[model samples]
Target: MITVVVFFSGSGIGTSTQMQHNNQASSSARERHPNSQIPLPQSNYAKHESGATRDSRRRKLKKQKVRPEKRKAGNLEYTNERNIAAHVSRGNKDRPIHKFKNSFVCYSNNARTKAVAVVKFYPFEGMDPERKAHYEQLSTNLIAHTRFQNAKKSNENTLGGTMYSLGWRKGFEEKSHLGITGIASKVAKDQEGWIKLFTETPWINDFLAQRFQDISLGMYREVKEQYDQQKAPSLTPFYMADPESFCGHLSFTFDNFYNKAHKDEDASPFRFAMWIPINKQTGKLVEENLQVEGGEFVFPEDGCAIDFSGFNGVVECVWKASEHPHHTLPSSTAIGSSDDRLGLSCLLPDSAERAIERMMAVEDGEKLDWTIQDLGHLHNDSLKYDSKGKPFETNDGVDLQASPPSACVLDEDSSTEPDKSLSSQLKVATPTQLHRST
Candidate 1:
């Protein structure tokens, strides 16, 4: 049976930065935490909405207008390499200090009517004090998690992206959250070494707690405030990865993992989402964004590509997954250095947090009249699928295939679940805004 869940955030929904600190990434792999010494981001970013602000369908967009204290941030310093950032007090009173923060620009598919925006604040967002605090807390939480114990390195430790996941394998089964038995190998295991950072954050539940309504509506408010448009689509944002952390992948020499052009999983919200990455050496907790040499995100809907190689931190208003075909260039072919990639991600707003609570309810057997979009388990760590959710071949021109692991961490042949890739080929169902079941 296929269930579809759709949550829409309408015009009556509520609402919810910028500047540059051109600080280069640090040399050491030390983690960062909240300290009084850190300066706040300098941007005039404030958003407020009430019931009175219902008609967003015809709202008009204004250029980036900053207040007295706020200044438009400088462009990200493009470099020959990539990295994320934390604090290293120069203590030089004469020199200006720069910390990472969020910034955005508004746009439309046709450059005319309905508008959407790209919101970015990754590696850091210094402008909003509240969000900055949350970033600090999140850093601290991940740092603590990574310190728990030594990890068993996988035998397949080879070249490619080094991302990891911390959730159960049976994502669609009842009590699936309890199914945590699984093993990772190769580049994934390398990334898994830092997996605790995601599994142990204090607000992880808040991140995973988003529902369709929260996402669709949040996108609405972001675009509404920026473009003053009357209508926002019901874009249900799901974590690019399942209820887990797909920390990151470092595109190494000859590794075909980072170059392919494709889309991310369908649940990702295109308008106003954050893309945060960190230095592989900086430990798991810190968010030190990298400006990868060739990692420019290509947008199909708009025919544009953004190069993060120069940007300090990322906070973009991306296109909805359903509407766009996005891909990045090959990561720099460099050996282990500050450019080596790794990072944690996800920050669900108020609406999405409540959706998570409702998900818990559904798991608890409270039947609601909602369409359950079943985005069957894609095994987030696999290199087989490109960012566009399409199959990819390695540098050797071979398709890398592996079965999803069993809940008990058994061999490939031991998988107890059916492969959704085959099931999806059968045209599973009419995918809802919420999820697409296998």
Candidate 2:
């Protein structure tokens, strides 16, 4: 009978003894295989399985070790590159990416006509007390020296002539008190009163005499001498051209007006309908159908309307200028259309503040708190007028208003909501005198 023995040991004694026995058997088999093939021992098979298990463990360990190291190295490289790029971008200061943001257009409306006013609000950032005083003086002088009038010459005949010679040279002071000052006061004090006043006031005609005088002084000495010798010096020589002669013409016609009549409603400020005229023949707005550069007319886009919910006071109006047919259209047409009209660019406190901040961001690395109170610019020098029916030599200065406190940090606590009730009750008057003549 054959006898088989089985032994078990907790410390792997049995397994060790078996492995030793397998090694001896494998050596004997290899010696025999020198001349003949020999089957592998069972113990040798167990060793082979152990070797495979060890290899699999080594492979798992290698995969686990390499993956995280590669990830960490890649992360470190990315972070280092980002830091270097940011440092380089910050170090270069000569980049031309920043510019001033103090320009804006202000539009006022009345019963019969809408007037668009443009202003450039200069803040009190770097200005000392003396500079502030100087700016205030400039504003006062601009108001004091400003004037307006209806041209004496017919629109058809004065296409390229001086404003004074055209026959309209009325001073702003001589007209009714419902001018810019009056409207500004109403806006600052009583919202409802201002709304009513704006709808009822008549459009004034005026040109700045001081500005015309300045332009006259800037003329070449030779030109001045020739005019002096002829005794027929054109007082407003700059304005003797077609499109320049018709710059300040207010000819828009009104269509409708809405009176919300509530002080707390969001839509109460002012709303009006008007017709922007384009020459039916050429599909443009121009004097005598002459195609002039920068003389295109545009109306607001369809379905676009003013929203006054966030403003304390909102004023909206339409502006129309005759443009040459060959002129390229503006990229944005939100305010106007191809049929000879454009829409007014909308403004809010946040947007105006953004503009001011952007302007200040460009000047120097130094930060400034600039409050833009108002923005506007003077017309081209060609629109000046003199006492005698001739163009004025001086150029008019545009009025810019600014207050230190007007610009404040934009925070959640700022109260920018418009007077809802007052804005709602206000009505746009369509029977305005300015609309009839246009």
Candidate 3:
């Protein structure tokens, strides 16, 4: 059994150390009193409890037995860190299935003080069925309202694609990388339903933040501080499910989503991904009543995968994405155009804080309309410029100075309504195009 190691509170006492000490003490006592019978120590509450009360407590413990399906060893495979590292180095190619029985915290072997990853089951612990159904329905609705772009480059066997992202993004000034800044990723004009869903449902952000804090305290503190700093007064476009989410960005994907093995080397350590299966017919959680077989989140490096079919509610996997190379296996049962699984990921890029700071510091009127081409890192010396600060034709014969802005840029004293026009101008490229470009 791959048992989870539970950490105990207090300064120097470890669970294993305490158990070993107790065992040793018991052995020593038995040696000294070979013929004597030693009475076992009892808890104060147990000693004072009535017979009926004790009987009731015993019955309750007995009723909470582990279910047989959860006990199936077919779902779990365990491997050590060394093996995992080796697999990653070789370019992860194999898919391993595992049953997710319990939530566990993975600490660094070299530095036990650092918690590198966490896997949580039933993240929506206290949510009643009705509430779970509501979230499931919202997820389905989001899928309907938004358009998914193909992730062609790293998709598994072309059975992939169907991915999209939302939140703050970094880009440079028009025709120049000198003024790199952050902005909110916008959806298409027709996708107003998706925008309204997030604006109207503020609790969704609260739920994400609360649950994020619940699993990892240290990570939550750092992320919360970053978000608070980003909320400072600014004209920088802020479009997200929740501006306060520890996740500066979110990506949603659907329709038999499966990706080739890869690592998000640029992502921050504070990252989490979720999978919620919805029934196509009823738009409700599949749960145990229905099954969406396969679509396991596989960690080739770890030699294991999280099979969601065994999960009754949403499962959130938080890990060091920069270090882990993972992919997914296609769903055997829920395949084709009717794929019902909805996937979500909360990500913070390693450069997110710096980008947000740059975006916030920019004064209202100086910001320019940046196209997707300006987002890449470019050297200032690479472009030819005259003494008057005017750009010349590049080596490729492309005139940077002649490039047109994606939207209309009006003067400060223009007759048009500034607020409405500025807001409309801010919606540069739709998320579908932006995601594909990224």
Candidate 4:
């Protein structure tokens, strides 16, 4: 018996003259919070909504008409060499930055895959100054609320920082505890501030939708197909549901950060992961400054890097992170100097694909009436099934291939006692959660 469980709600760039001061401010903010365990910033983003209100928000988001600009494919800047083998580094210190003379889109020389693309584009080029500032302030607060625990080091110990994963991720039975389809990563407060940030930040969403229009539309279609809008109303995505989100996961890296070459698991090679660098001081977007140095996006595997050191406006790197071994040179306020820098990347995780596979396996005629909390009894391994109708085994050593009749089985004695695990107790609204109309 597959016990049905509840579904949960799920839940930019800028200018110049405005650019210089913004970076300075961001650096200052990082200085103030340097490793301090301050409380999460208050709820200045959005108010908690009832289910009815959430429905209203969804209708509004659908009707909004935001379109992305059409960039010419002719502007692409092609590189010379193709790297077929994996990149080998000798003590992270030997990596060099590739400095380009002009701003252009980078494409690896490989005729076969064309796996990486680094474009020099400014996300907030034409936006209003005040509005851009508002976005920055909110971002700064979000950064301040975050406390880095372990320094996520790449290349052994060459580059590292306090990393925070904010959006939806694959459900782990022992970790997330909910064996259901997908779950949101935890934030500072009971997700109050985080939810507000997701809902209130429409400008950011619109920018992402516009910048990666094709990917956004593709993800929207995939989501709709997996969870029918009418049948799985509880699974409605957050913000303005339309194409506000292109990917299911977001990762933020705060001050003292650089990446050693690495590949993301379950990443989509066909879809690009969007990377936006921010000034750690103001939480504003990272503007290009000839005087500022470092922060070159390097792909050791490809023997190339996109140097953001001297660009005119802002820079955004859209690359196939799942297919490439990439890293970044430490960014600073000036050449050979150190300062706070923040980075964010957006991608759809493989776990989500697994979750969707499980969800689609359910009989179409059945109504998904379960709540998010009820998913605790489901096992992640049982969530995915082989084409032969056998459940796959997860790393947790759950013998799911034994052909158990029900995926969710409570041990004989605990059915009445009620297991009080953390997964079964969560109740919060996220961007992914949508309301069902009464």
Query: Could you tell me every candidate's TM-score relative to the true structure?
Result: 0.36, 0.17, 0.53, 0.48
Enumerate residue pairs that collide in model 3: 75-98, 75-99, 76-99
Pick the winner on lDDT between candidates 2 and 3.
3
Work out how many backbone clashes candidate 2 has: 83
Quantify how close model 3 is to the true structure by its C-alpha RMSD in Å.
17.5
Q: Please give me the total number of clashing residue pairs in predicted model 4.
A: 24
Candidate 2 residue 202 C-alpha distance from true site, Å = 24
Q: What is the lDDT of candidate 3?
A: 0.50
Which stretches of candidate 3 lie above 4 Å from their native place?
1-99, 123-127, 148-161, 170-195, 229-243, 280-282, 334-339, 350-438
- Model 1: per-residue lDDT, tens digit, 1-438? 734444446543322201111232221212254342444434333244443453442242122233211211211111101122212223344554232233333234222223233434444535455554554454344333333222312314323444332322222345332222232222243333333333332244344223111333445434334221211111111122222221111111212224344443432333333344444344232334443555444443444444455555534333454454544455773455444333332322223323334443343233343222221232343344554445567799887775544332112222223234523443322322332111
Q: All models: lDDT?
A: 0.34, 0.25, 0.50, 0.44
Q: Give per-residue CA lDDT, model 2, range 137-207, as digits (tens).
A: 32222222112322223323223212211111111342111111112321333333324432221211112
Q: Which one is best on TM-score?
A: 3
Residue 39 shift from truth in candidate 2, angstroms: 84
Query: Candidate 3 — worst ten consecutive residues by lDDT sum?
Result: 429-438
